[model samples]
Structure formats: C-alpha cells, structure tokens
Target chain A: MSETPLLAVHDLVKHFPLGGGVLSKARAWVRAVDGVSFNVKRGESFGLVGESGCGKTTLGRLILQLIDPTGGSLEFEGQDYTKLSRADMRFMRQRMQIIFQDPYSSLDPRMKVDSIITEPLRATRRVSRAKRREVAVELLERVGLQAVDLDKYPHEFSGGQRQRIGIARALCVRPELIVADEPVSALDVSIQAQIINMMEDLKEDFNLSYIFISHDLSVVEHICDRIAVMYLGAIFELAPTESFSVAPRHPYTRSLLMAVPQPDPHARAKPLSLEGDVPSPIDPPPGCTFHPRCQHTFERCRKERPALVEVTPNHYVACWLHQKGGGKGEPLCE
Target chain B: MEKLLEIDNLSVQFHTPEGVARAVDGVGFDLHRGEILGLVGESGCGKTVTALSILRLISSPPGRIRADRILFEGRNLLDLDAEDLRQIRGQEISMIFQEPLTSLNPVLPIGRQVAEPLMVHRGVTKREAYEEAALWLDHVKIPAARERLNDYPHQLSGGMRQRVMIAMAVVCRPKLLIADEPTTALDVTIQSQILYLILKLKEELGMSVLLITHNLGVVAQMASRVAIMYAGEVVEEAGVMDIFDRPFHPYTQGLLKAMPRLGDRVGRRAGRLNGIAGTVPPLTKVMPGCKFADRCPHMFTLCKEKPPGLFALSDGQHARCWLKDYPERRKAHV
Candidate 1:
C-alpha cells in the first residue's frame, strides 16, 4: 500500500507578480499557491477543494507541472520531478494528464475526435498509424462512445459527450495520475453523475490515481479518499474523506461544510456562519488568511499564522483552536 | 397568501438557421407575495428563458416569446405597451443574471451604476441617489460600502461584483426579484452568503422571488416551492419538502438521485451513481411525446405515443407523466 506514494508535494509556492512595466519594479505578488504540501497515494483519488481565487486550480497545475513552482519540491514516484529538465519533464508529463473544467474550450473545435485522442500518443510514443487508430477506437468504445463518434467534431457532441472525449484523450496517454479540475462542475446533475461514475469505473480498470480539484464538497466527499481544504492559497485542513465528513477540525472547514446546502429541504435553516469575501490575494490577511471570516477567531488567530498539524490521528488542521497548547478541540483560543 | 406573480402557458422559441427551437413550452407557475419560487433545470431546458420572458427581455429577430398571460400584481405583462413595460421592468419586477460582470456597466463607477436606477425611477438627484446607493450596498453587506462607491465593477472581486449586481437590481425595491442562478458563479461559502442575503432582502422588502438555477441544493435551501423543468416544459411542481422527500416525476427523482449529497457515505469506490441514461432531448426537433420518455426507466408505450398532461396530485403536487395518469403505471414509478 505504501510504494513511495504516487506523488509527494513539499512546501510548494507560486506567487504570480502583478502587472508591471520594464521601467517600473513589480509592486506585489498574488500568492496563488503559498507553502502548500500534500501527497497522493497509489490508486487513490485525492481531492483539492476551495473557493475561487483560493488557488486550487493553480495547485493542480503546479502538481501536474503545467506551471513551474516558485519554491519547494515536487516528488513523483520517489524522484524529484520538479528538478527534471525540459525534455525530461515533457516525458514525465506523459504519465500525468489533466482534464479541464470547460470541455468546450479545452478541445480544439476544428480537430476531430480521432486526432484529439491520438495527438498525445503521436507526441510521446513511437506508434504506427494503424496502431494509433486501433488504440483510438478501443479507448473511445471503453469510454462509452461509439467508434463512429471518433470522426465527429467537438461541437457535434453535447457537454457530457464532449467530456467523454476529454476523458478518452486523457486516457490516450495512459497516465497513472489524472488531474481532473472541476470536470463535472460544468455538466448538469444527471450528466455529472454519469461522468463521475465513469471516472470511478475508469479508476478501477486503469489502476489510476486522480487529483480531483473542485469547489464542490459533495463531489469531493464522494470521489476522494482524502481531501485538503484550501483557503487563500493554503491548505487549512487535510484529512481522509471519512474523517473529513465526521470530524472536520478547522473553523474554516466547518464554515465551508455548513455553507454547502444539502438537497433535503429540511437542511440549512440557520444563518451563514462565515462572513465577508476572501481578502485580495495580492495582500492576504496578516495572520491566518481565514481569521477575518472565521467565527472562532481570537487573539492568536489575528496575530499568528497556524501551521497544518495533526490534532487527531489522521485529521490535520491549521487553527489555534486545535493546537497542543491551546487545548484540543475545546473553547476558542486565548 | 395573495399571488404576486402568475405565469400561464409561457413559451419561448428561437428561429435558428436549421429550424425553430422551442426553448420554453407551456410553463406555468405561481409566486405568492413574500415567497420564493425556484425554477430548476439543466442547460437548454429554458429556465432562464422563462424568467426573462416575464420582463419581455427576449429580442424578436431570432427569439420570440409567447404566453397566455404573465400577470404581476393583477396586470398582464404581455399586454403592456413598450413604455409601460419599461416603466414596470425594473420598478415592479427586477432580474439579476448569472454573470454580473457583463450585466454591470463596466465603464461606470459602481456608485453611479447603482444610483442610476434611483435617479431614473425615483427621480432623485445624483448626490441623493449616490447616498442611497451606498446604503443599499451596505444592505448587501459589501465592506467599506461608502468608500467603495468610487470603485468600478472591475475593482471588486466576483463575490463583490455579485453584491454590486444585487445592490443595483433591488435598489428600487421591486415587488418581484427574478434571480437566474444568482449564486452559481460564486464559491460555496460565498454562495450561502448570497442566498442568505437574498432571503434577508426578500423578508425586509416583502418581495416575491423567482429563483432560477440548475442546483437542487440551492433550490432546497432558498425556495419554498420548486418547479422542475426539462425540454422546455415544467415536468414537476411541488412544495420543496414534497420534491425532496417524494419526487413524483421520473425526471425530478432522477435529478435528486443523481446529485452527490454531502455526508452521503454511500460512495465506496467505483460505486454506481443512479444517473439517468441518455441526454436531455434536443429542442431542435419537436417530438410528439414525453421528452423524458427515452431516458425514463419506467417507460411504457403510452409515454412514447402521447405527451402526458400535468396531473394534479394530492398535497398540492403536480407531475407531468403517464405514471401519474394511471395507477397501474404509477406502481412501476416507485
């Protein structure tokens, strides 16, 4: 079960500099992914969840090496893949694919399904034309698409069908880890279930590990083995899905859980616990990024940033309320 | 309770190059004073069209709107003259869209845009309108509302921009508020805040709301009654509790089952999600039967032969299905 973990991320940091000219110095940096660390295990689905601008997407991109990190290391298969050179990383990328949120824009409108699926194989593997066609048809059929659909353009298919094509393309590379960034958020409820079910089945058939990034906690709770709740570009809580749903330690995590309205009409009768919008990333809060909106915030929360620490066996939280000296899961910190 | 808004047999069609696409067909609903009526559907299901049709917002060349009557406060909106409709559009009825950025006047300062309605409708002076706008912004809980008046729409975050949109839409204190997926664009935590804000404002102003969205959870949280739409028709209309606890229509049941509920531990890996097979029937063709017939698990010969009428069930629930028409067919529904 513990074969060096599928992917290990350590203290990752990516700060995008705001607009500046050659004459003027960079005024400030938007801390997109700041000092985040996590691990994805073999054949496991890891979820990254947060609000918009919390940098869940940025973290996904960094982990996939679509973008470079400003600091820290990314270890894949027990090797420091972050240090890999351009060509080496290109080869490494063949093993880690990404499925985008918007199926409309992700696929080239002009390109047919055949080309879209086979393009990755052509770029990486030395496969014959006949072999590529065979693989394309086989993968298309596997993803519940008819072989006839291989010749159709992206626009011909509906949102769910387009997503299937996107999946086929990701599987075309035969990657071990797939980064699905809000893959089903764009689809309807019925279609969302279809795609999520298919992905679950694919995970089993292909022996794949997934880094599922979404703001939807329900989907995350359903699909992920473990989850990391990000707020303002940092993980405030990391726990196994079971532990996460039952005993969420972070104040922000509790607020997020409370905010998600259930389908039952009886649910969510109370007022919203969290207050205010996420502060600007350009200059996030001075102490805990979530302190301003957090209900349990106190003196320590306003002044000192909390690090992710294991208060329970598996549940890790970044809040003074759960700290050792502050007393475990008790009253608000002094 | 008195009915604030009554829509009867409302239909919207688009004259595309290929054929006439009926986006909404025979949609009817009632919104009582100070009540929230949720209109929920997937993409292309015409929930948005129904909301827009109330204000006659559809442009006539490619789009055409038709209805038996759209009564708001005892006046038929369909019979109103252009000038009369204009007077009633933002004053008697107001609407906020999914994308607030495009809806907002990007070039104008937030204060001026928010105050524009006050000057036009209430005939307040510029200074007076601006002061009132600031107060409205504060009502929506925008931080530093007075100081942020000088800022443009681009300056605010997504949540902030949505708040600005809300401030502008309800600043005149309209009798009816049509929010088409108001919180769909915002994050989870912010979504609850916005929903809470909408609820608060509705209570304070004694306004009826027509909330349109694809999310059942949000509908369950906000709406007192819900109307499920599919293929341009209202498939099911019931109290929120009835819709959640016992959905009569097959489509409504499918939507509820398909949604991944928070804290539902039923997700063991590769676990099948009860997704409704087949996609939403395209509006390109006018089929002569139940739109959901192809996807319904309990499909019968009658379902394909004739479109079912809305059968009035006990406890104020109505469902458009052959299953509801015959007790024998209904036995298969459960």
Candidate 2:
C-alpha cells in the first residue's frame, strides 16, 4: 500500500471533433474525458463508473496509451508515460494491458483461442513458440477455461466462455495494470458474478492492479476498493467503496444509488427520480455539468464550477452543495 | 382488485441452428390496475421474453409462442390476428425498450416520432398530432418541447430520447405499459429522470406497468410486486417488500446476497460477494429438474429429480423450489 501509485493521471482530457469543413468550418468538440485526475495504487482495484458516454472507457484507453489524450500527464510506476516515445509506449503497454467491454468484438474471430493468448506473449517477446503454447494453456486454466478450448474460435464459445478467453489473453503478458472496461457488462448476470470472482482471485494470485470501468455500480461495488463517479468527462465523487455507497456526498452519487432498483418492496414506494437529461458533451454546461439536473442546484451552482475538494479525510467531491462552508448533503429547496 | 393484465401458462421458443431454444416456460402472473410489477432475472432468464410474449411480438417461424392466454383488458391477445393486434399494440398496450436509439426512428424529428403513435393508434390529424406530441413531450419533462420539436433523435441526449420513447408509449393512454430495461442504457441521473417520468405518467393515466430488468435496485424502487424468473420459469413471486424481506427461493437469495448496497457493512466485512457459480444452461437443453439446481447451495436429490411447482406462501407470496415442498424446511423469515 505504501508503494508509489502504479498509474497517476493528472488533468487528463480527450475531445472528439464533432463537425467538419473544407474552406469554412462549423465544428465543436465532444469533451469525452475532460480534466480528470486519479491515481491507481499498486495492486488496488480502482473503479471508474459513469453512464455510457461518460468518458470512463475513453479514460481507460488514454491511460494505457491506446489512444492519444487531448491533454494530460500520465505517470506509470513513477515513469512519465505521457511523454514516452512511440516505441517506448508500445513496450510499456505490454505491462499495462486492457480487456474490452465486448468480448465478441474484442477477440479476433479468425484466430483460435491459443493464438489469441499467444499473440500478447509474441508481441512482448516474452516467450518462445513451444513455451507460448504451454503458457497459453496455463493462462486459459487460470481464467477457468480448459486446455481443449484453445483450439476453438471466439464465435465457437458462449458469451461467458468468450469473456474468459478475453481475460486469458489479457493475462498472457502478465500485465501489472489491467484496464478492464465493462468486462462483464456483455455477459449474463449469473456469469457476471463468476467472472468478477475469478478476477478477484486472479488479482490476489498475480498481484495485479486494475482500472475497472463500468456503469453497473453493484458489480463495481463488489470488486473495487475505491471508486470514482464521473460525469461529462470529469470526476464528481471519489471515495472508498463502503463510504461512498452508504453516505454519498455528491447529489449525483446519491441520485445514482436511489436510481438502482432494490429488490425490497418497500423501496419502490418513493423513488427519488432525477429531474432532467444530461447536457450534451459537445458543449457541456458551464460551471457544474450536473447542475442542470441536480435537485439541490442553486444559482451559485449555475455560475461557478466546484472543485474536487476533500469532504471527508479520504472522500473527494466536486459540487457547490458540498462546499466546505456550504453543507454535507442535498436539501430540498423550500 | 380486477386484473389489468393476466398471463396464463406462457411459453416462448426460438429455433436456432443448434436446436429449438425454450426461452420462457409456463410463466403466469397478473398485473392489477395501476400497479407496477417487476419481472426480474439474469440475462436469458426469460424476463424480456415474457414481456415480448405478452405483446405477441415474437418474430415469425423461428420464434413461436405457446402461451395459453395473454388477457389484457379482458381480451385474449393470443387469439387476435395481425390487424387486431396492431390496433391494440400502441392503443391498449405500449412498450419501451432498453436502447431508445434503436427504438426511435433516426430519420424522423422528435415531434414526428412522438406523433407517429398518436396518428397510428388514435387516428389524429397531422397538425393535431403535432400539437399533441408537443404536449406529451412537455409532460415527459422535456423543457422547451415546442422549440425542440424539429430536432432529430441524434440532436437530443440519451435521457431526452428515452423521454420521447416514454411519451410515445403513453400518448394513447394504454391500459398496460411494458418497459423492458428502459433506463438501463442511460446514466444514473438520466435513469432517475426517466423512471420518475414513468411513475408520474402511470399515476396520471392510471395505467399498470410491467418493468422487466436485471437490476434489483430498480425493482425495489419501481415495482409494487416482483416476479423473480430463472431459466424459463418464475421461481418466486411476491409483493415487492416480501420479495426483498423474505426471499424464499435459493436463486432469489443468491441474487440478493450478490448485490452490493449503500451501507452494506456485512458485505464489506465478508470481502467476497456471494457469487452464483456457472453460466445459465443453454435453452436447447431439456432439464428434468429445477433449472437452478446446479447453482443452488442447498440442492438435494429431489431438486435434481423434478422441478417444483409454484408453492403458495402467506401474504400472496409464492416460490417454486423443492425446499418449499417440505414444510419443515420453510423458514418463517428470509
């Protein structure tokens, strides 16, 4: 725990071009991941949760240098990765692999399971042909897949089995930091638990650190030690899993917890439904991005942006309602 | 206490290259007027299929429905031909899906999309339909609905698109509305907005709702009653509070135990979630016993010998499990 952060991101930003032109241009930038900062401690599972277009997945890709950041500083194991040369970044990537959301699309249908896993070992120059096969089989076994499954294609397997193959490939290079972007979202719910359990066991066995990204809070709550709730490319709340879930400071976080359908009959009577749509990312609202839909929004919220300040000793939140002098939680406006 | 919708001995099958996949089998339930019934299960547990079957929307030869009856407003929808079904589809019963993007027409404006249902089902004139559409949009809490009428589906945010979907579904004031994972695709804040909109509309129209979803948190917040399904069957059905407080079926117990909630001190102390092991069995395979037997912790020989029928419990609670058959094994509480 005392070891330096395995990955530290400072002011990370990613903006996609929204429109095009030849002579004159009418364009806007979709601010996917904007000015976000976080640190993933070694061997710790840090979760990044937001809605579909909230930029969590983009941030994961940016961290692994899979895509270039619009702006940010990235340091991996004290080594500045943002400034790394193309070849250096490529070599460094072997130590920081990623598992995508859709295992069906992520795996090459043309290739066999053995070849898929061996591909990483080959790319990293980590093993010879004979050893790669042996290692691939072992990796498959590690992810609860059988050695015989190595000969099958991605489409040949079921969704759960395909996800296991995807996991086996990610583990082939023995990456210290794995960016698993909604790895279980595509699988069946029953299978989601199995994979999450396997990932937890694998983390302990391999001493791995993960930047797990997802919108499903329940799954994230089960796997992550710490969680960062993001909105419109920026972090709204970051805290320990237990604390964040119980007494969420951010209005958005509270609304999120309230939004999840609990199985209890009593819970359904008075749902705290959020008020409005999220403003477009192409031109996110000024000040607080969430202010537009926030129940506790004030005139101050619309005019001034809040900083991610420490609310508790460890918990951080970026909302005017939770300002040091303001208050602790969202109170209904009279 | 009249039933708004009644499903009897419902079953659905899809023919694939491998074999005939029996999706939903012998599912029966009743939705009281203005009541919100949550149909919950993991993926492939037939929750969505059950909803689709109620609408008689299962695609042709490859897909077949063997339901004894789907009574809506005292009419057996199973016996209705295409024309009769079409008339009732949006007028008597409406449906909303997980992804609003796919459900909406990309080429059409928001106003047109909303108006389509009004014109089709209610036979309103174009101008009248447009006016009605604007009002419905405003009803769903889309600000400046008149000005935003011309905007295409892509122009609005995810939450707005979902609102449009809801507005269209309820435009004709259907007696029963089926929302299949409506908010699962949106962010938590947006999800809340949509759920809130649905709740408001249900109250206003006095329409019953059947919400099909894998998210238990949503069921707790939205459902008045819950039907917990597993591998083509309803394992448990109870009042929402009873399902949460005194879950009788082992599958229901596992699903509850697996979820991570706010202020879950016991969950954190345990460190590991109660993960259900193994993937859902393929629908093509015929099982002689309880579908969840392989995953159940308290499985006995009887569990594997024959599937249990729905056993009545106090307070309208019911569950299908061999454990329930033995009076001694029935615990007084969850």
Candidate 3:
C-alpha cells in the first residue's frame, strides 16, 4: 500500500443556518463541525468521541458527504474528491459507507433481511439477483447470522441480531472506508462486546479503515488506534488509545475520562469541579469554546483561542495550558 | 443498616398481543437507608421492570404486578390503595427516568416542573415551592438557577433538563429515590456532575437510592451493593467489590469480561473479548430450566432440567447457578 491515508479530512466545517425568514438571511448559525482535521489510515479504526451536540455526528456525516460541508475538504487516496461531479461522487460513495446508531429505524420495517443487506449493492452497481443473495448470505454468516435470518424481518430479531444485520448492510458494497456512528451505543453490554470485537476482526479481514464515532470513552479507547476528543464542534485532544485513556492532558479530555464510572469499586471519581452546560453553538463563548466550563481557564483562555499543538510524542491538545508560558498543566522538561 | 425498602418475590407480567411476557419474575432485593443499591441488567432483562414494580407504575389490563411483600418502612406498599399510594409516592419515595425531556412537561417552565413535587407532597404554597425549586436547581449546579426556572423544557439542554429532573426528585426530600438510568441520556462530563450531585444529596439528606442501570461503571461508583439480573431473574447478588473481583456466576463473569475497561487498552488485542454468545431469551417464551442456561458456558444436565435457586456463597453474596451447588466441581474447570 502507498503512504497516502485512506481518508484525510482537513479543516472541515459544517454550519447549519437557523431562524431566518423566507426573504431574510440566516439569523444565526449552528457551528456543528468547525475546522476539524483528521486522517484514517488504511486498515485503521479512528474514533471520534464527544457528547451530544458536540458535532461528532456532523463531522462523521461530513466525511461521507452525507451532508454538504460549508468549507474545508475531504481527501481520499491523496485526491481532493469534494470537487468531483455528481456522477463521480456516486462512484466515490461506493468506496465509503455509514452504519447508523439506530438499528431499529435505520432498517426499513417493510424490507426483508435480503433486500436490506443488498440495498447498497443494488444502488451502487448492477448485480444479478442471485449473486446479490449469495453475497448477502456470505456477509450475514460473516457477521454471525444464519441463512434463515435472511428471510426474517428486523422486528423478529433481538437488538444484537439487528445490529449484526446493520453491520452486514454496511459491508455489502465492499467499501474501503466505513463510518460507524455509535454502532454499539444502542445495544446491550454483552452485545456491544460482540459487535466491537467483530468490527475489529472485519477491519483486518476486509482491510478497511473505520471512522468510529461514539460518545462511549471506554469502547472508543478499546477499539480505536487513535482517539480524538471533541467539544463544542472542535477537537480538544488527539492521541493514541494507550496514552489517551491512561494519561489525558487536555482538561476537557481529563474531565471526560474522570466522568466515566470506572468498573472497579475501589476508585471513585472526584466531584466535578467544572460548572455549567456547553455553551450555545449558535452563539458560542468567545475565544475558547471550553473556557467557561474549564477550571484552569485564565485571561488568555478567554481572549485567545489555542491551536492544536503537540504536548508529547503522538499526543496533541488544543488548550492554552499546554502552550508556552501558559498556566500549570504539566511540568516541561529542560 | 436499617432496610428502607424490602421487596420479596416480586413478579411482573405484561399481557402483550403475542403472549404473556414475564418481564420480572420472582425478583427480590433490599435497599437500606442512606445507601445506594444498583440493580443492573441489559435491556429486557427486567431490571427496569423490577424498579417500576416497586412504585406500582405498571398500567392495568395489559400489565400486572404481583409481590409477596413490597415493604417500605415496615408498611406493605402492595396493599396501599390509589389514594394512599398517591400520598406516599412523592413524599416518601420518588423516581427519575432516563429521558428527562420526555418525562418533563414540555410546555411548562422548568421551575414549575421542579416545584410541582414540593407543592403536591408537602402542601406548600406556590410561592414557597418556586423558591425551594430555584434553590434545589442551584444545588444541582445549574448556573443562574432563578433565570433558568422560567425556561421551558425545550429551551434547556439535556444536562440542564436532567438537573431539573434531579431537583424535582429530591425537592421533597424523599427517604428513598428510585433513579432509573438518570444520567444515561447526558454527556460523560454532565453525567459526572449529576452523579456527584446525587452522592452529595444522598449524604446530606440521608436518602436511600435504588439506582437501576446497565453500565457497570456507574454501578461501581454509586452502588455499594449490586444485584445482577438476566432473563427476568437475579442471576447474582453481591457487594460491588465481590461483583467485580470475586464473581461466581458465569453470566456475571461473562458480562465483566465483555466490558471494555479503561485499563484494558494494553494487551487488548492479545485476547478476544468474552461476550456472552447468545441474546437474552424472549420473555414471551417459558423456559423450564435456568433462563441463562442457553448461553451458559458451564451448562450441565441440572441447569437444563431445573432452575437453580439463589445459592448462598457468603454472608451477602449469592448466585442462581447450578454450579454453585457444587463449588468444588465448578472450581475444576476454572
């Protein structure tokens, strides 16, 4: 394989205009994905994690071009494909697919398992009906389902089985990149484990890249090679899972990690020192979006927006505290 | 510790179109005053159904609840009439749900919603209720509580709406709080804040909390004792440490192993996650043996023939598994 990343998103932005009259311009803009940048290498599972309305979903949708981006670019195989024509974009979409959070709604109630799984195949290319069924059965078995399930409706299956079918549908087109948005969030813990492990194995089997989007920290850390923490439609910290979960540098990341109820009863989380909900995206706090909720915020944090800078090897954070001559976060070596 | 609420042989059945769904079957647990007992299970495992049964929240005709005894402060709640139960509902015990938005009245301002319990239970004047509501909201860490009191449910963010829910649940100073996945809908950071608030209020007010959730992390942090339910039965009951470190039930062990822990990042790939092989059996079907037998790795002749009663392992720990009958025999496999 070449050195080029399978998917590279640079300074991506998506702003939803709101509350405008028929003739008037948009009164306000919801900054859903603001200047986001990341790369998913071939056969890599890159995780994008954030709370609700933090724009993680928007960012994922933007990557698949499921929605139009306000600015920035999506590069596939070192090629800027955003400038491609409609017909060309359809061809590009064949290489990328998305697995949604809601399996119950994502799958059509009227459609049988065969039609649901083979929908992508039918849409993307002209395949024989018998061949589609063959491919569907193969994918179903691969995803831990049986041939009999191909005739059943979604309601007949359990949540876990439905999720497996969802995975099968996502892989039916033989996509190089799969954008899995909270793929396991809707399922049970036991089922979540099964889906995550299967996804990991499938990544190796298909040699595919995944932009795994979820609000779940432990799952993200477990499954992804690289993790990016998003807050208020911006990346606060990005690093490998080993360093990210164990030793988070960014205050937002640390706070998020602290919030997770550790499985061990011996360790109890300290009371949250921070205050207030995330600021309105329509009119976000000036300078740093996180300054209002960060305990370590200073005058500079309120006046100057920090850029993503490397704090350690493979560890990057967009926080003033990590900047030179900034407030205490970590002691720098001479 | 004195028992605040004691449930004995609780069972709930929903008369669905298909058949009788035994949602909660012969389940029992105890919650002492000034303590949190986490009732945990995946979706459809009857943890939520068990909790709802405590308050007689199940509707008639379609739903029916039967219990040998649901004693609260030495009184049998099962015997209480609608009028009598109404008096005890918010004054002695209150419950919070997963989705605060759906639970809260969308048209009503948050202040009124939070203050309603105080007015209904305590017979306090509207003025006094509003005043107390504002204070409680502030206590839950909602910024500018007085200003937010006028905001409708739609106007407030998810975290803020949950704060409103908490304020309402605790404003009456109920001796027992049935928190049904209270923070499940909020972000991780907001979840921590809510948990901290619950702990602090539980400390100050000396309240017993029956915390129901699927997340083990939440149980670890909040619950002193835990009851693991599967397929409408309590598979395991133990202290938090016992559940995590010395679990005896195969189902419990499988769940813990299935979970992707924050500390499991290293050497994760070396071992595949041990997810339970099958989905929880449908409630409509009547299984003669142990409900978890189908998925149990250590299923024996006895487990498939007859259900195992709660086998006492230690003073407070028990497991509903046939292997518990012969600990020595079970030890041989491990």
**Cand. 3 TM to true fold:** 0.96
Mind giving the per-residue lDDT tens digits that candidate 1 earns over B263-292? 876335424678889998779887888999
Q: Is the docking of candidate 3 incorrect, acceptable, medium or high quality?
A: medium
Choose the strongest candidate by lDDT: 1
Q: Write the per-residue lDDT of candidate 1 for residues A1-334, one digit (tens) a residue.
A: 4569889999999999888778887788999999998888889899999988999999999988888899999999889998888889889988899999999999999999999999989988799989999999999999899999988999999999999999999999899999999999999989999999999999989999999999999999889989999998999999999888877878888889988887878865587778778888999988898888877677887888889988777778888888867633563422
Q: Give the per-residue lDDT digits (tens) of candidate 2, residues B198-236.
A: 888889999999999888878888888999999899999
> Which is the better candidate, 1 or 3, if ranked by DockQ?
3
Question: lDDT (0-100) at residue B275 of candidate 2?
Answer: 66
Residue A332 shift from truth in candidate 2, angstroms: 15
**Would you estimate the TM-scores of all the predictions?**
0.96, 0.91, 0.96
Q: What is the TM-score of chain B in candidate 3?
A: 0.97
Top candidate by DockQ: 3
Q: How high is the CA lDDT of each candidate model?
A: 0.89, 0.85, 0.88
- Model 2: per-residue Cα lDDT at residue B328: 67
- Chain B, candidate 2: TM-score: 0.96
Q: Which stretches of candidate 1 lie over 4 Å from their true place?
A: A21-24, A327-334, B266-271, B330-334
Cα lDDT tens digits for candidate 3, B1-334: 8988999999999999989999999998888888899999998889888888888988887889999999999999999999999988888899999999999999999999889988888889999999999999998878899988899999888888888888898898899999999998888888888888889999999999999999899999999999999989999999999999999999999899998887687645535677888888889999889999898887777877898999899989999988877655464543
Candidates 2 and 3, the one with greater TM-score: 3
